[model samples]
Target: MSATPATPGTPDLPALPVLQADCSNCFALCCVALPFAKSSDFAVNKAAGTPCKNLQQDFRCGIHTRLRDKGFQGCTVFDCFGAGQQVSQVTFGGQDWRGHPGTAGAMYEVFPVMRQLHELLFYVSEALALPAAAPVHADLRRALAETTEWTAADADALTTLDVGALRGRINTLLLRASELARAKAPARKKNHRGADLMGARLAGADLRGAGFRGAYLIAADLSGADLRLADLIGADLRDTDLRGADLRDAIFLTQAQLNAARGDAKTKIPPTLARPAHWSA
Candidate 1:
């Protein structure tokens, strides 16, 4: 968890902004909608559409602070990308499934879909913010508008929506955005797309603008690595060491990804993200 040395008086850069989860505005849909197996990641076997054992009547996690301590590390790292609020507030009109038993089934089904759509929003928002993606700005804006509109639909409408098809189209556009961004650092080593880098010893590697899409970097040592503008879409970072790494402008990194990784005070992160509370100094 050591940081690379920086010159005195150097200032941190602005953090990249993206659609993020606001758990406070949510009704804890994740606790009810998703299932988990009893493994290292979770302490119990849970079924889909059923509430977890640790969920309180107030719709808050009873063990939120001690999730990892209690072997529910998966819960600690999961992010809904703002879907929980959209589902609880917008889609269902503040009507909780628990209050209306009939709505529980539909609510659970739509929650995952909304999570996926919100995830797309995260990417679109990121692409729109990238100056290098100006060539596709028009298309990105259009997609954002359309997706925003779709997210406003009610439960039945959401259930029938072809979210997978929509995701495909967005992925295509995002790939272009990534290409444009990575073009900034052409000399950097970046062709590790979808590689199994689990527990890889990549500490201090110069990974500027690298493509880490879908890479399994579980417990990988990334301390002091320069990860600026790196494409981190869908990268698994559970227990990864990121202390002192520069993740500024890294593409497609979610709060979930950051929460899952281990870092220290010296790790540079996007301005939009807060350092995980669990991180060691």
Candidate 2:
């Protein structure tokens, strides 16, 4: 498919270095661990833990060049944050899951979890990149280092992790990071607690770790905002623009919240979230 020119009026946000797709070290985990159905995003149906028919022995998508035309648009948007390689090389000691039947199931389980951790790292790293987040740079750096360490752990450690507990701990740091970053931006005088900010323009604004419980943020423009470790419980986020916004370790943010949001190909939702139906439209 031809590249689509970026439309004007859409916020021109800073590109995040942490979210870059690195395929060289990956083992095509998304093509194997995740399942898909024939839809606007995929050309055929696939099952969980089943390798994609188009995935080559070397772990590359055989249909990479024609993914969009073949209805695999979702694959094109997925980024594993280098977890695929980390799992394949470091965690599993360079074992090919397919070749070694003994490690296959463990590899499948670890892939998704590592993807989640790496995705979290992606957001945390992005928050660290923002100049407005200088106040929390030290904490961000610590969190980045800690998360990176987790990413490099052995397969057994990764497999046995209490993922929910790990996520909770990470969330605490992210909230503080967000608050410190948002404090640097020029904004209104009133506190934004529980504010209804649906469809609001918050591009490039520092909103680190803001308490957004039950807030209305439908279609809000959040590109380049620092949302690391923010409390987003019960927030309404329909049609929100989250490209370049760091949502790593954000507390109480759910797939349902994101499903209600109007996101696009560039919007980076949590790994727990399925692609919203409205996105590919």
Candidate 3:
């Protein structure tokens, strides 16, 4: 669903089926393996490895349909990138922690690791989809293959893997891929990489080809801003206003970022991403 243009060298990007989370195939790992303190996002404090009060016996959230209405807004924005099912079904052979209490500790420990790996795969897959990044496609393909292999490793192998090193290594190629794609924009671009723009008013600004990598745009007003070709890797978009913004062909923009931001029906997002259900129709 990516909108990247196709060139001679860049083949059509295949769908990344494994990158989409399938909760039915998962054991509700996120509700138990991760901890969240009571805040604007969560209703109560839950310790790591403890099953959430809202979690049901069948491994589904009791308040899933009303997560936001019940003060668990954080859950709506979090995406495991299919790591839960990978850990539960593939890594542990579909073993539920409740049935195998002895594996709970290890499962909890490996979930985060697997989540990080899956996240990287998501980014790498997006990078591969970009036609402008054809120069680095070979490297991106290798990185994707390697990351996919790691995702299939046993729990023991996964827990011991050096994720930081792998992330650092893959990030280099992603950065280059971002640069190549951004260079295609003819206009002069802004470099706001890692800037703390929280709550700033940036409505209607032209931000095409802008580099927002690792930037903090929390609660920033970006309504009607032009974000085509912007590199948004690792950017914090919590509560960012994106109404009427043009994000077609935006690089490195993830569903999690879109879910955290506020938008209206006019917001033009990448074809690959879905409009957040909370957004106004």
Candidate 4:
């Protein structure tokens, strides 16, 4: 997460200080709770509940700076969206698994649940920030409050939460928000929702106001494309070349998605998102 704070919020909507991952305040839950397969992105297979060998006693990655070079490129793309720290510090009261083995199982189970809730918080908070989405602001606020309440629930309630149903409800409001925001763009928007455009040669395409929601753009050559006002919620951007692409004001495009793709210094992104450090300068 960027050091810069999010935009100020109103009485109905609160600023999102906890939406960004703070690994230092976490107990390395992701390294242990999540399973990974041995692939081009990972050097070895890891099962759920097993700590990564690189996780230090202080809960820091031993090769944090060299993850990509060490064939752990998948780690670089993952952002828990503050779920790690929230579960470690707030949910478990800072009781680490090593220190309290009794809570380990429950803590691990709740971490992923909390992660989904935090992700929803991130999207709703971003939607609230958009001035054009004011028409649905009331619904967004209610969704935000309900989601926030869930994050504060106990381990049992969190683990059993019907997150899919909650996501379905929130997604409706998000779609409405996207429609309102995209209408402000001065271009004929293209709807590529859920389209499989993998490895497509689309460099320098005039994609302004395009709807890429849930689109599979893996390995697509989107360099120098105009994606302003594009709705990129849930888009698979792995290995997508976004070098010099203009994504300013792109709706629901998260930092995790930007981290998953390839880019350069010339890639224009939304102000709220930080430029990936791995991107060429």
How high a TM-score does candidate 2 get?
0.60
Would you list the C-alpha lDDT of every candidate in the order shown? 0.85, 0.67, 0.90, 0.90
| Per-candidate TM-score against the hidden true structure | 0.91, 0.60, 0.94, 0.94
lDDT of 3: 0.90
**Per-residue error at 32 for model 3, in Å?**
0.5
Per-residue lDDT tens digits for candidate 2, residues 1-281, read 11221221224322222333467766677788889998766789999999999999888889888876777766765556667777777788877877787988888899888877876765565455445556655665566666667777777888887777866776666656556555643543224567979789998776655678668887799877767546575476755787666676555466546654555666555564566665643
Task: Order the candidates by TM-score, highest first.
Answer: 4, 3, 1, 2
Name the lDDT value of residue 250 in candidate 3.
89
In model 1, where is the ten-residue run with the lowest total lDDT?
1-10
Candidate 4 per-residue C-alpha lDDT over 123-205 given as tens digits, one digit per residue, 9 for 90 to 100: 98888777888888878888888898888888989988999999999999999989988998888989999999999999999
Candidate 3 clashes between residue pairs 3 or more apart in a chain or in different chains: none
By lDDT rank, best first, the candidates go 4, 3, 1, 2
Better of 2 and 4 by TM-score: 4
- CA shift at 16, candidate 3, in angstroms? 6.4
lDDT of 1 at 264: 98
State the local distance difference test value for candidate 4.
0.90
